[model samples]
Target: MSSTLLFFIVLAAMALAYYIGRQRAIGVVGGVSQINRLHSLPSYYGYYAALLVGLPAMLLLLLWVGLQGQILTALTLAELPPEVTADLSEGQLSLLTSDIRNLASGNLMGRDPSPAVEAAAARFQQLQQIATLSLWALTGAVVLAGMAWAWQHTKPSFRARNRVESILMLVMILFSLIAILTTLGIVLSVLFESIRFFQMVPWTEFLFGTRWSPQIALRAEQVGASGAFGAIPLFTGTLLISFIAMLLAVPVGLLSAVYLAEYAPRKVRAWAKPVLEILAGIPTVVYGFFAALTVAPFFRDLGQSVGLDVASESALAAGLVMGIMIVPFVSSLSEDVINAVPQSLRDGSYALGATQSETIRRIIFPAALPGIVGGVLLAVSRAIGETMIVVMAAGLAANLTANPLASVTTVTVQIVTLLTGDQEFDSAKTLAAFALGLTLFVVTLVLNVIALHIVRKYREQYD
Candidate 1:
């Protein structure tokens, strides 16, 4: 049977186990009226029985399904003659198994298979069928055994509620550990790859070098193939664009948030907030198109009319559109934090004869400063991490210049460029992507730490 069908069957079995356990618990206490003799409610016995049946059976099914492919492939390979496998590397052997399984399942292979490959494919299919049948039998047996054990243990004195709670708590803890470990694994993996990249290219050059050409030549005879990996220009471009984005976004977003929260009528606020937030739902790729086609051209013409030089694709164009994109994030978050401030504070300010403007500036703004800072930080991160807009609007020149009209590139754009196609991971060119990623992560982390310090300081001063 299919795993999905077997999953539903297991669920049905668990439901039956629940019913049986509940009835048994009631019977043990003599009747529903005399259920006070039982330690827990009859529903607790039902839950305990369902848990007992489902947990073991589901775990077994999950492990069996996870390992079934490996086991089948191993059996198929073992059945093949020793000489057939002796010449293949680990990677080639894996590919051979994948192709055999694909052929057995009536899928196309890259080329016609040999006699040994055909035989292996047949063996794989046979093993897969046997494995599936065995899984169903084992899972059903486990469910039945769990049900019987639950039925036997559903006595009046059994602490079914405690057992159920303990099991759930353990499950929750296990999931939490999995999440923490996943995050740790990601960081360590990036850190190690970045270390490898640094080992090849000096850290000093990568960090302070002005150019970022990562095209390493495939052959030593190729001219101009030794690429530079200085990231200073990328860093400068990223900061410049993000700075411009925030410069436009923070004031517009924050002020709009204030007006909507404190000045707009209820009828206006209801529709205006949602309409404003619709900007956030628009895809970033669409913003990229708008930046490239509309904003960039407009800026070019404006700069030309004013007798100023403007690149066709420049940081100013990308930043302006990016700023518009993050407006909703800033406005929505700031509005929420503003609304969260106590009404009592406003009333007290009014009683002290403070004007509304004065009260907002002195009391409300400072009180809401932390959340405002947090919202602004989120928008900043969004701006920094933006790829499509930069790629489409700002040309990837990586020129070390402060002029917004000049063409520049960011680190994210470089990372995307370096890892765009099928490439070897061992080369410094590919490993440079990992180094760039780790640097971005560290920069973001530092920014967050600074934001936290700002929030704490303002919170202490205001509260």
Candidate 2:
């Protein structure tokens, strides 16, 4: 049976077990009227039984699915002629295995298989069928045994609720461990690849050198193909665009938030907040198109009219559109933070002869400053990580210039470019993407840490 079908069958079995367990509990308590004699509720008993039946069977299914491919592959390879496998490298063997599997499934294999390969493919198919049947039988047996055991154990004094709660707690802990382990895995993978990249291109050159070209010539004798791994230009461009975005976003978003939270009428605030937040729901690609097609042209024309040179794909266009895109993020969070400031603070300020604007500027703003800063940090991170807008509007020339009207590229754009084509992972060009990813990850992590520290420190002061 297919995994999905087997999953549904297991669920049905669990449902049946739940019904049986609930009725058994009621019977043990001498009917519904005497149900109060039970240690736990009938629902708890049902849940306990369902979990006992489902969890063990699902775990067995998962373990079988995870190991079946390796086992089948090993068995199939054993059926292949020794002469065919003796001289094959790991990569070649993997490709041959793929071809065998494809042939077994009657799919296109890109090339005709030898007789030995065809024989192995047939064996593979037979083994796969056996594995599937065995998995189904074993899973069903496990489900039946677990349900029977749980039903026999269901009694008036059974601690079903405690057992269920303990299982739930373990599941929660397992989920948390999965998240932490996944993060650690990512960090280690990126770190290793980055180390390899640095070995090819010196760390000092990659970190501090000004140029950013990453193309390596296929032949050593190729002309004019010096691959520069300098990342300074990309860093400069990213910061410049992000700074421009923040300049446009911070004032406009914060002012709008303040107006909606404190000054605007109820009806206006109600309608305007949602309308402003709708911008966050719009996809970044749509914003990219707006930046490229609409904003870039308008800026180019205006710069031309003013007798100033503007590139067709300038950082200013991307930054402006990105700032607009991030406005909702800033506004929504800041509004909530501002509104959370105590009304008592405002009254105290008023009693001190402070006007409404003065109260907001001095008292409310300080109290809410931590959250506002956190929101701005989040917006800044959003702007930094944005790829579509940078790729579509800002030209991919990694020019190390401070002029926003000039073309530039970001770290994300370069990473995408480096990894887009079919390239060997061993090459510096491909490894550079991992290096850039690690740097970006570290930068964002630092920003988050700083934001959290500031929020907590100031929150404690206020509270």
Clashes of each: 0, 0
Model 1 lDDT, residue 155, Cα: 90
Give the clash count for model 2.
0
Tell me the deviation in Å of residue 141 in model 2.
1.6
- The sequence of per-residue lDDT tens digits that candidate 1 reaches over residues 1-463 is 7999999998998898889889999999899998999999998999999999999999999899899888888888989999889989988998888889899998989899989999998888888888889999999899988998899898989999999999999999999999999989999998999999999999999999988888888798998888899999999999999999999999999999999988999999999999999999999999999999999999999999999999999999999899999999999999997887788889999999999889889989888989899878878888888899999999889899999999999989999998998988999999999999999988888777777777667655544
Query: What local lDDT does model 1 show for residue 458?
Result: 69
Q: In model 1, which runs have C-alpha deviations exceeding 4 angstroms?
A: 89-91, 453-463
Top candidate, metric lDDT: 2
How far does residue 224 in candidate 1 sit from its true spot (Å)? 2.1
Per-model TM-score on C-alpha atoms: 0.92, 0.93
| Global Cα RMSD, each model | 2.3, 2.1
